[model samples]
Target: MTSLSGKNAIVTGGTRGIGLAIARGFLEAGATVTICGRKPENVQNALDALADYKDRLLGISAHVGKSEDLEKLISASEDRFGAINVLVNNAGTNPYYGPIVDSEDAAWDKTMEVNLRGPYQLSKLVARKMLSSGGGSIVNISSIAGLTASPLQGIYSVSKAGLIMLTKVMARELGRQGIRVNCICPGVIKTKLSEALWADPQAEKQAAAMKALGRVGTTDELIGAAVYFASDASSFTTGAVLTVDGGMVL
Candidate 1:
C-alpha cells in the first residue's frame, strides 16, 4: 500500500466528484489534505461531510484559473501544512459542449484557463516549494478526451490534450529536481462533470459497451492511481500518462 502518512496534499475542485473522492482516499491513507472549491458553501459542506478527518483536512474557496486565487491557495496551504508534498490539479471546466466552430470565445478561454493554464501555473508554484522541501509529486487529472476527441466536446478535448503535453513538458524539466509530474486520463467517469456521458441512456450505453469492464467507472476507481502518483510507490515514475478507462479507449 502507498503510505502518505507524513505527506501534505492539496486537491483543487475537491468539494465533489472525482476530486472529492481522491481527497477522501488520501485522508484514509493518512495524508493531510487541503481541498478547494469555488464556493465557500461547497467547501464548508465538504469539510462537514468529512468531519471524521477534520484534523487532517482543510477546506478553502478559490478559483484555480485565477492567478490571485491560486497564489492565495498556495500561501494558505503552505501556512497550514508547511511545505506541500503533493498537488493534484483536478480542477477543470467545460462551459460549452458543442462543435469546435460553435464554441464561443468565453467557453474556449474558460476551458483552457481552468483545465490547462491553471495546472501549469499551480505546478510552477508548487514545484518551487517541492524543490526546497527535497521532493514532491504533481498529479494532473486529465481526461481520455485528451487522447481521443470526444464528440461535441471539441474545445474541452483540445484543452485536455494541451494538459497532457503540459504534463510531459513539466515532468521532463522537473524530473531532475525530484518532482515527478504525471497525468491520468479517465474515461467516462460517472462524475457530475461527466453526467452527459451517463445521464443519457444512449450515451451511457455506448460508453459502457465500449469499456472492457462493461460499465462506466466510479470515482473510487481512480483513488489507487492518485495515491500511487502521490506516494513514494512511484518514485521512479515521471512524465508518464496513465489511462484508467477500463479499456474504453481500446
Candidate 2:
C-alpha cells in the first residue's frame, strides 16, 4: 500500500465525483487533504461528507481557472497544512457538445480555460511550493477524449488534448526540482458529469459495448492510479498518461 502518513495534498474540484473519491483515497491513506470547489456550498457539503476524517481534511471554495482564486487556494492550503506535497488538478469543464465547425468561440474559450489553462497555472504555482518542500507529485485528471477525437464534444476534446501536452511539459520542466507530473485519462465513468451518456439505457449499453472489458468504469476504479501517482509508488514516473478507461482504447 502507498502510505502518506506525513504528506499533505490538495485536490481541486473535490466536492464530488472523481475528485471526491481521490480526496477520500488520500485521507484513507493517512495524508492531510485540502479540497477546493468553486462554490462555498459545495465546499461545505464536501466538508460535511468527510467529517468522519476531519483530522485530515480541509475544504475551501476557489475557482481553479481564475488566477486570484488559485492563489487563495494555495495560500489557504499552506496555512492549514504547512506545505503541499501532492496536487491533483482534477477540475475541468465541458460546457459545449457539438461538431467542431458549430462550436461557438465562447464555448471553445471556456473549455480551454478550464480544462487546460487551469491545470497549467495551478501546476506552475504548486510546483514552486513543491520545490521548496523538497519534492511532490501532481496528477492531472485528463480524459480519453484527449487521446482520441470525440466529434460530438469537439471543443472539449481539443482542450483535453492540450491538457495532455501540458502535463508532459510540466513534468519535463519540473523534474529537476523533484516534482513529478502525470495525467489520468478515464473513459465513460459513472459520474454526474457523464450523466448525459449513461442516463439513457441505449447510450449506456452502446458505450459499454465499445470497451474491450464490456463495461464502463467507476469512480473507484480510478482511485488506484491517483494513489500510485501521488505516492512514492510512482516516484520515478512522470510525463506519463495512465489510461483508466477499462480497455476502451484497446
Candidate 3:
C-alpha cells in the first residue's frame, strides 16, 4: 500500500479516462490534486464530481500542447496547493491514424507536439520547482505504441517512443536534483481515444488475444501503477518504463 499523503500533484488531461482515474486515486491516497483539461465544461464536471475533496482538488482548463496554458496551470497549482510534488503527464493526441508515408506534416507535428513535446515542457517546469522544494516524482503516460509498432498509428507511435527516451534523459539529468522521472506504457484501454481499436468486434478480439490477460484493460487498472510511481514506493525508481498493458507485448 503506497501513500501520497500530504503531497501536491498536477494531472494533465485529467477530466476523463486514465488521467481522471489517476486523479481519483491520488485524492483517495490523501494528496492535493490539480487536474487540467482543454475544455472548461469537462473541467467543471470533474470538479463537481470530485467536490467531496473540497479544497484538496482543483480543476483548470488548459491545453498541454500550449506553453502559455502550461505555465498558467503550474502557477495555479502553486498558488492553490503549494510546490508540486507529483506530475502525471497524461495528455496525449493521435490526430492522424494512417501509414507513416501517408502522414502529412501537420498530422506529424500535432502528434509530436501534444504527445511528446507537451510532456517534455511540463516536466521541465515541474522539475525546477521540485528541485527547489526538495524533489518530486514525474509519471508520463506513454503507450505500448512506443515500445512496438502498431498498424495505422505510425506517427502516434513515434511520438510515444520519443517520450520514452525523453524520460530517460530527464531522469539522468534531474536525478541529482532529487526528481524521479518514469514512464507507463498502457495497451488497448477501453477509452474513447482508443475506441477504434476496441469498439470493433474483430479488432477487439484480435487485441484481446494478443494479451496474456485475454481482455482489454479498463482505465482503473492503470491507477495502481500511477500511484506507485507518484508515491515513495518507487523512490529509487527513475527512467523506468512500467507497462500496464495486460501483457499485450508479451
Tens-digit lDDT track of model 2 for 134-200: 9999999999999998869888888889889988998999899899999999999999899887889
Runs off by more than 4 Å, candidate 3: none
lDDT by residue for model 3 (146-224), tens = 9999889989999999999999999999999899999999998999899888999999999899999999999999999
Output the lDDT of residue 184, model 1.
96
In candidate 2, residue 60 scores what lDDT?
84
Instruction: Give per-residue CA lDDT, model 1, range 69-123, as digits (tens).
Output: 9889988888988889999999988889889887689988889999998999999
Best by lDDT: 3
Query: How far out, in Å, is residue 22 in model 1?
Result: 0.4
Better of 1 and 3 by lDDT: 3
Listed per model in order, the count of residue pairs whose N, CA or C atoms clash below 3 Å is 0, 0, 0
Q: Which window of 10 residues has the lowest lDDT sum in candidate 1? A: 94-103
Cα lDDT over the full model 1:
0.92
lDDT of each: 0.92, 0.90, 0.93
A best-first ranking of the candidates according to their lDDT comes to: 3, 1, 2
**Where does candidate 1 clash, by residue pair?**
none
